[model samples]
Target: MIVLKNPHLSVHIDEMQGAELRGIYTPDARNALASYEWSSPTPVGRGASYGSSEMDWLSGYRGGWQETIPNAGQNCVVDGVELGFHGDASRTRWSIVDQGADWCTLETSTRLPIRVRRTMRLDPDRAVMYIEGHVVNESDLEIVFLWGHHPAFPSVDGGRIDLPDGCTIHPDVNRSGDLLTQDSPWPMAKTSSGEFADLSEQPALGSHRLLYVTGNKVGWSAVRQPDPYVSVAMSWDVAKHPYVWLWTMRQTPEYPWYGRASMFALEAQSAWPYDGLAGAKQRGQGIKIKPRGEESSWMTLAIIPNGSGTVTGVTKNGEVTFKSSEMH
Candidate 1:
């Protein structure tokens, strides 16, 4: 386990277990964030790699946040080999290459010829986490990559989702209870049976819904709950990561889900359709890196305490703006 602190918060990363974020909680802030918890449950033991099977994949899950590369969905072929859920990034360990008083960096490489480096920064004055990352494609051939940041938030009965205008939804054809699969406007969609679903609100599905969203010129999402009023917001570079995925499940009866899981994962991704790189490439939305080339991006997340207001938007500098009104 690796820990980084900034007087107000303590961020823990499981360096040996897929380098996933174990948790982020306030230590001395004594504010609304003090009660914040990890979205993902702790792992049963050291996680096993996704061995082209759901059991192997989920056995390794210790999720708070994870990085997915080359692929971001279920088992599929990437560069001729079957890549399971979220690819090797979340299945491999990362090395702690650097650390200091308020920041730490992690680096990992994949057999797929990609190297990912992540650095997280915190400060004494704010309840936020900043992550900057760079990816290098060291292979000789240009390759399409489906990369994303998988930050799962615990489900709440009154969970409300917020996004910018012009956004539309694309339901994952592979998942069940796809209420809205077409290109509808943001936050509202009609099921195939013609029932309307408020995308902004998370409900009891009895099943699951996986989808990708477009029109993220304003790249951000917030999951707000009631009672304690603690809110979590995630913001990323829309230009680099143009797509966002909504992996909201309730009582999913599948093997990995086991009919006893509930979580809302608003994934900020760089590719599409969840059909692996081949599907993303066929649709021309898949991103590719030139031989020996690299790309960089950053994401910022905020923990809003007291949670009395709605986060209207977040600036590039990580300033969160909100109003007194709640969406739900």
Candidate 2:
């Protein structure tokens, strides 16, 4: 485990395992990132079957944050290269290129023809962590892929999700008994139960949903927990990541959860659908990179202790401000 600390926040990362972010800490929350009962901290050997990538990815999923690249979901073979579930970027080991008191740089190459490099930096006087990185295609031909950030936070009862204006929700899998299977404006959606449900409010356990929040004029999201009164705000470049994947696993009865998990992951992605690169390309949602081409993006995670239930905005530098009406 590689650790970086400042006066206001602490950051942890596992360099050997996809450079996975283990957790982020502030004075009010021990670890603000979501966790799981079955997730392992150490690497697990891969299974023989190609479809085993999901299990392989989950075997060591500590669930703080992960960098999904070259492929975002599922397993497929493109150009004779097998892309595992969530891709190789988060499953392969990364080398530490540099480190300091409150920052570290890591680099790794994937089974595909791309290379990734990222730097994690903690602010000196704020509860914020800035992640800046880029992915490069080193092969002699163009490559199509999906890239995104998977940051899961612990589920809180009565939690709320905040987004900017002009955003919409596109449901892919709806088990929440709420939300139409079609696109709905930002927060409110009509449910089959003959009532309106606030998509912004986190649902209770035993309900799960896989959806995409698109039409983002700006890239940012804030999850506010009422009881602990903590707000986690994430910000990024919308041009680089136009869609946000909202995954709510509230004690889901799926393979990994088995009715024993409760967490939410707001993934900022460059593509649509949970399908792998092949499927993404088929739908014309995959990103293309020419030989020796590189693309860069940055993200910021900010924590507000004892915050109001709303966040008006979050900047790339981690500056956070809450709703004025809710302020004391």
Best by TM-score: 2
Error of 1 at 221 (Å): 1.1
Clashes of each: 0, 0
Off by over 4 Å in 2: 37-51, 173-178
How well is each residue in 1-328 modelled by candidate 1, as lDDT tens digits? 8887876677877788667776777664322221223333333344544444455766555347888876777657766777767777787778989998778899998757889899999856887889898989988988677778888766667878888777888777666375755767877777877888888888675747887898788888877777544577778988778999888777677755665667778889988767766677778876678999998888988776544466778765668777756633
Candidate 2 global TM-score: 0.92
Candidate 1 lDDT (Cα, whole model)? 0.74
lDDT scores in order? 0.74, 0.81
